[model samples]
Target: MDVLAVSIFVFFFLLVTILGFAAARWRRADNLDNLDEWGLGGRGFGTFIAWFLIGGDLYTAYTFIAVPATLYAGSVVGFFAVPYTIVVYPIIFLFLPRLWSVSHRHGYVTPADFVQGRYDSKPLALAVAVTGILATMPYIALQLVGIEVVLQVMGIGVDEGSWLVGHLPLFVAFGVLAAYTYSSGLRAPALIAFVKDILIYTVIIVAVIYLPAQLGGWDAIFSAAQGSFDAFNTENADAIAAGEVGAKGSIPPAAAHWAYASLAFGSALALFMYPHSVTGVLSTRSRSVIRRNAALLPAYSFLLGLLALLGFVAIAAGVTVAGDPPNPQLAVPQLFENEFPSWFAGVAFAAIAIGALVPAAIMSIAAANLWTRNIYKAFINQDATPKQEASQAKIVSLVVKFGALVFVLALSKSFAINLQLLGGLWVLQTLPAIVLGLYTRWFHRWALFGGWAVGMGWGTWLAYGVSSPTQAHFGGPLVPFPGTETNVYIGVVALLANLVVTVVLTVVLRAMGVDEGTDQTQESDYRADAGDEGVEEELDLTAPAHG
Candidate 1:
């Protein structure tokens, strides 16, 4: 049964890879030389593909595994992901069009590029670059977590093989991912998002619909899940009590209103700041495209709410497994394997694996854009050609993927999850730099760095202090309540600190007559269309690609 499921999973993944590499020709662009074409799909994806691409990129295998797993573990905080996503779309709706217009006008593929072009401040751009890279690494590692959870549930691992067993799966997973990503650039994953989302939707919708009937229905599932929650909180009630105050350094304890609000708010701020999400937003051809996506993207958030409940559904359905990790990330996959036919389970597994592919490609591409503009073009080769920059991006992307792969294999699985919590910590720190930088350049560049530094330091220190049953010192989400044993997300708390520092420092810096960096854009540029000043000119490529 496991072998049959594995084969089906392999077959579908292969198909996606073929389709991925085939994307270079999907739209059939004249020249893929410019970053505009390769990085942002020529800045011209319409609504349908844009929806799936953004949705597929945002809702990855980690989401599939991790959301349900959070429910499974009786930690309500995991459920915060749903509301957080829900709120994020509306927030994006408010800001994304402005960002789209500015980025498109400036021919910027990354937020850092925009920061560099907008403020004309090298240090500020560099800070955005470094923050993006740091935040994205753990996110990429989280993709590996989704895949790993699927592998573990499928009962496939290295215990049996001499050479091909332990290392082969990793090699194969990355090799195909790397191959297709390099070949297709953004288009591969953008095109393939349609299939990935469909499979995920079908598998999840079917599972949620059918599993309840098989397990006695929604009432039964809910009651059973509630029972588990009661048991978990009672047994580990002390820890749950401490989470409300601190949110330690990551997320708050899932026990009450504050937990949901923090998760929703913190994730809302962090989501747009992440490079992959920005990549998807930046790829659209026009401001209208971004606005439409902002409004429609919330539809995906609705699906996420249903998906979060599945953890409780799994719990209530009396699902059980052997040798399970004490994490919720595994709940959905384990539930499917326990409750469904192997053939159907294969479909679920494929949904997760392919889900990982879309965002992984987008993330690698976004990270590559950062490297090309911020590092390579900005500092290393100010006079690089378009083709040269494109080629350089391709190479750097491979290194980034491998670096994440090393982070995955080196860190303990438990530690990796906490690292994502820390990613939330770092990504939130970029809000003032990227998202706020969109509206006003009122704050000084040096002040922005100061706020980021303070927030990051406090967040890291708090996160380092958290402990859980399986590991110690940065092993669990940080919490603050004392006697009652509650917890809060560290990122939310740290973000508060960041905002304070940014506000206070901005005022101080302003009073001190600091050079707050020049704003290259006026308020009008945020609403500019395709024909405006500094908008991309279709110049002959015979010259260089530098601005």
Candidate 2:
């Protein structure tokens, strides 16, 4: 192990751990025994904190490791993340404020809560809640995978010993994350995000500026990456032609144009559908804060573009991994280790590790809140008090983190990765139920539920049918568009099917005189801001959920 690097890593890690536990005291809520205070940091975060927290939540440790790794491995489509982030902000600007308004007006803590209020359908709300939790588990696992890669790069727990011995550090890190998140709730991540974003920006700025200068220049970096791709294509020409492996490239070919565009658009739609993203948006102070942060968040997309280029820099610098087939996820971390001074490399490692913690905390908390409000409070104990709800959420948050840890440790990393890819597709199924409900209650609740079921089943089937060289199922996000040779994102295609079913079923159901559930929200509710007529300073914990 590099002693200096490990020391710096440990120091920063400890700093965040201290910040995490201290966050509960930082906010100093009168009582956190309610969803509003515990699940959402009192629902009072301003522009600056919301910016960092949501940015940190969306641009995750997995992103830091995986996006560059895809580029380093010569997959040009991975750069879709830049455009995906760009596309998502305008959508957020348009719709998330409405969600925030309606959620605040109804004391809704999760998107499912909004669904329940809008449609007055418990079964539909439960579907949304369950989808959120299932999709989030593998996402949290990917964060652990991010930390594990950094640990491996640092030689922290790699040894000629049992699996348990090799992953003790990971377990210890998991323990720390679970402890403070259970204590501080959303405040933990909201506070630590300041440190996480600063460190990430510092490292990426330095890497983009310093690495290119060291490796001759951008010209040499591109040339090196292209030459490497050419060599690999030549070496594996048969495999490429036989459909066993994909050709490498710096730019998407004409054949991949639809694939690239669809991935970007699909990902943009899916990003905020995740419960954690909703958690970030709802925690903000007002409608304007959501819009302001949406506009400002694009700056992170610029940063992501620069960060993605580091993959080419890694190629030029000749960073390599040790594996039968080299694990590309290690490329960026390996580049930091090989190119930077030991102490600075540790800073970069800590950035990735802390990047994991912030999102993991938020995801677990979001999932827990779904359980408390939508599942536990809605079903098991309809008359449960706010304190009981909070207690359940706290315990479930720990359970969620522990489940994620087991997902990473017991299962193959590839399994978690593939499931995360499907997670995006699965969460997109809820878009009609949640996002559409904000605008109009035209679609019947049962129709929305049917659409979700169709989308979930079809998307999973499509993803499962995809096969890559190393994996037989759940291998990728893109599939051949039906009745055409062109490939498109599975989520986009599944969503189309979902919409078709929902639109058709709605007309039939309305004509048949099917009972549309009572709409609980008024037209003005969507436009309400903080301190509006029915919006309370704090959520009314004792108020019954609207049906």
Best by lDDT: 2
Off by over 4 Å in 2: 539-547
Cα lDDT of model 1 by residue, 1-547, tens digit: 3988898888888889889988887765676777887888777776777889999888988887777766666664666777788778778888888888888776778998888877678877888888888888778878877787788788775445564576567668888888888877898999889889999889878977898888888888777777666666676656757653122111343465564676568778888899889899877766776778888888777778778778788777666754545555667888888888888889889889889878988888888889998999999999999998888888877888898788778877766677777887887888887788888877778878888888889889888987665556786545663344555667877877878888888899889988766677778878886556665533222333322
Error of 2 at 501 (Å): 0.6
TM-score of each: 0.90, 0.98
Q: Candidate 2: minimum summed lDDT over ten consecutive residues — where? A: 538-547
Candidate 1 residue spans exceeding 4 A from truth: 160-164, 231-255, 322-327, 476-488, 531-547
Residue 425 shift from truth in candidate 1, angstroms = 1.0
lDDT at position 395, candidate 2:
99
TM-score of 1: 0.90
